[model samples]
Target: MLKMKPVTRQKVNIVIDILMFVVMAALAVIGFLIRYTLISGEARWEKFGSNIEMTLFGLDRHQWGFIHLVLGVMLAVLLVLHIVFHWKQIICLFRRLTPLRPQRYALVSAITVVSLLILISPFFLKVELGESIRGQGERGGRNVSRTSGAYLPSESEDRTPLSSEVLNELPQTQAIHQNQNRRHGEARMLEIKGYHTIGTLAKNYNVSAAKLKNTLNIPSDVSSNERLGRIRRIYGFSMREVEECILALQHSTGDQTQHNNSQ
Candidate 1:
């Protein structure tokens, strides 16, 4: 068997330590980038405008998330290697901490079991849904429904225009494009969220509310004012499917426009 020299082993340990540190730092930085800078679409719209698209280094949040995941995998692998390399030292330390043979083995087994449970906990964790999308009511975004806590918008407020307050809150660049409402002559896609109501989506995306309901298979009895998230919970449909349907509707609209121009 090929055995590493003492010097070679020391150098390998140093390399491993350095790589682990670098990977950990990178992981933290990317995690912050995803959480704050490249925030969720819903957050972006609330902070900026629905028209605004946030990106860092030309990569969207999802792309950054992929890189973040890769970094996490690398960190986990490096951690395993680090533990393997220092296994003898670990055993010695445990022996000093718990001198009894049976106790030492029990301590080690308990720690190993705890570490594994912690690692796998995320997969088994339950995800919770939040309140459905509510409309901006005339009473200053207050007065939610008694049953659902959702603000029922009147016909005039149903297609609520971007309020001046919201406009003022936008960044200077976003403020400039607020009125233009054009994205490189292409239709913009809004990020679908549970809080979004069918009416709000239809009005914002320039699709008919009836068509939107039909596409999503939301029954006529289900109010358009009800939040998409609530509807999904009741009907059992993925948000991805909703987004795809919206995109398809936009594409069909664009195709019709092109056909008309060609005639």
Candidate 2:
């Protein structure tokens, strides 16, 4: 066996910088989609999608808080890295600034200072711009509250509530019910016979080993290598009961597979 050489700090820094760029870009795109499509009602999805929309576009008071926080931290890290990378250049620039025209230097400094303040303010400021936007929308004609994203309404507008019966009736409850049904079906379908390992059980059920353990709440006293007796003790399931449950699951799975095949 050969030992691999450790990765260099420069490589790690580059990777981190690249990742930062990717995350920032993704955040920007998500923000834009939430703002333009979701807010404007040009495109629609489920309620959670709409909630996500609210979160991304800063419609919800609590939304964008984490985003802002994460971005602020990333910006700080980036700033530090940038300064570290270009320390000599930055020092030279500052030194040369005195020789430049006073008005030009003042303007540059002002812009730089303002930009830095904005980058840092979100970390400290508790101001909720989302609430302000929502309030404005409520006062205005556009019914922004119904959707997930904040809507900008005109000043000279009626505060009449728009009909949100459609949006309010998002099928989240139905989707949740279906998901629960599916999980129950899956749990029922999972079977353990004579001697089976958790890993094998998980593989048969097309689920992760961790998920199987979590679903069953397997006791810590039951070692991974323990026999069926431990399972019976932990779950209070007799051999007959276990067999019946397995049969029920097999039937259900067969029916589902048939239905899917037919479809």
Candidate 3:
């Protein structure tokens, strides 16, 4: 093979810096899309309440998170290489900023602390804002429970959260959770084996969809294709209780129809 052009140290550093810029820029764009597009509902698919299964760039958010981590490691390595290339200039700049003296150590320490605080400020800001909006805020750590969908469990029903053993014992209950990763628009509520969405169940039982949404505390904007088991889990209600409620209304409707027909 013909000998290629001789590589130089300066050229290598320049190439690494360029690659770093590209990686950082790409990460910035992806981070913005993940934080804003996903939260702002501009993403192609609706998120399932903190579930990371929504798609972007042909990959789910969980997959994207892994990619982001790998890119982050690459960026860090490039940064270290850049520092190695510029070690002399960095030493000179540090000397110019502050001489290595015992009296100057406090000033350097203060600068480092302040710089770190500034770099991490956005995270603290988000936490404060979240607490103000939806967390246990100025109420002295007291959290106000949401007012709507406050279904009190009857004496015969259990309001306590399910134990893992009890949950495992419930037949078919694990099936919905196992298949929770079904893609958007691929959820086939009516055809899914032994699983049903609130809308489909309501329609079959001749009950109002709005009633189902209200009684189950499901969000109104939730798609009709969401499985009933998923909604029950989200709303912290017993699946058996909801199913019984639906069956009761269905039987009552049938009885009324037969009596009216006889009259």
Q: What is candidate 3's lDDT per residue for 19-120, written digit by digit as tens? A: 999999989887886776544321221223211235776876656667788899899899989989999998788777777676467777887899799868
Please give the clash total of every predicted structure, in order.
1, 0, 0
Local distance difference test, per candidate? Answer: 0.63, 0.45, 0.53
For model 2, residues 92-145, the per-residue Cα lDDT tens digits are 887677566786679778989999998789699886543122111212112222
Residues 140-187, candidate 1, lDDT per residue (tens digit)?
A: 122222242212333433334344345346542343234222112222
* Candidate number that wins on lDDT, 1 or 3: 1
TM-score of each: 0.48, 0.31, 0.44
In model 2, the Cα lDDT at residue 216 comes to 48
Candidate 1 RMSD to the real structure: 17.6
For TM-score, the strongest prediction is 1
How high a TM-score does candidate 1 get? Answer: 0.48
Ranking according to TM-score, highest score first: 1, 3, 2
Q: Provide the lDDT at 170 for model 1.
A: 59
Which pairs of residues clash in candidate 2, taking residues 3 or more apart in a chain or in different chains?
Answer: none
